[model samples]
Target: MASYGGVAVSGGMPRFSDTLINGGVILEPWAGIRAYASYAEGYTVPDVGRIARAVGTAGVDIDDYVNIEPIVSNNREIGVELKRGPLDASAAYFWSTSKNGSLLVQTAIGAPFEIQRQRVEIEGLELNLSVKTPLPGLTLSTGYAHLIGRTDGSANGIDVVDRDLDGANISPDRLNIAASYVQGSLSARIQTQFFLSRQFERTPNAYPALYRFDGYDTTDISLRYQTGFGALSLSAQNIFDSFYIDYYSQTVRPNDNAHYFAGRGRNFTLSWDYRF
Candidate 1:
């Protein structure tokens, strides 16, 4: 992949271009198992929309635009899957490194926006399991993932832990379990997702670890029925009414109390579907 763009400045328009390559492979030599491995290289440019909004605003600097650089990354992963009888399982490990990775940084204290560059290293593991019970049309599935990331170099004058790290915004651990049943024209499913606690910066200017959002889980259920005319469906989201803060809301703070965007409470929806 490749991209080209320019920023208007007093001197001239600074232009940039980036290229990326990606590929992967898989092998299945046994009836119940398969193995796979993959590698990829990619890059990203700054968000021009956000930059446009900041232009001419107080405390915003044109140098912010000049400092922006394309972020590049190299990633690799390997994993295996197992399938036997009514049971299936899989696991994988992945590692990635980013060059000039862009992160929210405080150009100065209380700055609303700033982008810093760093070399970042990230690694993680993922797992999944599923089983189909003898019970007619019933299945259970579960999955989990854990990740960790840190700055890769020391030239930026900040310790890996002091950079208001962006990775901290991501929940390091997550789990999801679900059950489904299907018979005739009727189907139903229920699921729950758990998020492990993570650290976050209240503002792009603050140390990334200044605050934390306690982990929380939410549940949802759905049911559907089909008739000669059309299908009817009902869904209950956040069935448990559990509350949580998503990643984005935690990263930026207009005020101390406003840092979190509360998770939605329980809600319901019903709908009809027809095909011509």
Candidate 2:
């Protein structure tokens, strides 16, 4: 080897030093309106317990099953909110970076991969709005999220500086919408979640099959009655029983029938809660 720890001739534990800053501020530009900005630094320890459970061989040190590396990330975000009259809305965008971000990748032998840390970057946007309708006892609410990630392409044996981060860190875009109605101690509502689709075609620069994704949506309806004793709620999920594969099962382990889990079918549930 040329050197140890980037030195001409030496051997010692790696050393690193840096300053961390975390803070945020909010300003109300006008009545019922506010703007905010923030920054934070954080790190998460690896889960040794879970890693140990996955070991099939004896005489293995679970704590040492994989590199006990912590991922340190820095995040910066800015957003604005408006709350006036019967309307409330907010939007925010964030960018994050981590020199030691962990991502999962399948092994060449078609087995689960060990946690590996690499350089990673991510960008995301969020939006939410809710309003009270004039039609008495009716309200509409919606929220949307968009996220994407990038990592050193060398992890995939490519010489490029950065490439798509894959499903381990990036989830397909999605939107959630719901409507509620209330009248005389009775409330009824419905909500739906829409999953965006993604496509990646294998080519000179990238491999697509491993990350291609399909879109799907599910809807649910619920009704509740308020009484002196408590509140009774009757709800149904995936009311239409839409048949589709889950996002992670399809994108993370594509083409693997064993892992192709289907979304839950239509089901009904009754719940009651009492006030103390």
In the range 15-130, model 2's lDDT, one tens digit per residue, is 33567789999999799999999999977765543333344454654333334456679999999999999999999999998876776655543565555566778899999999
Scored against the true structure, residue 3 in model 1 reaches a CA lDDT of 18
* CA-lDDT, candidates in order: 0.71, 0.77
Using lDDT as the measure, which candidate wins? Answer: 2
- TM for every model, in the order presented, reads 0.77, 0.82
Model 2's number of clashes is 0
CA deviation > 4 Å runs, candidate 2: 1-19, 49-66, 153-161, 200-204, 207-210
Whole-model lDDT, candidate 2? 0.77
Best-fitting candidate, measured by TM-score?
Answer: 2
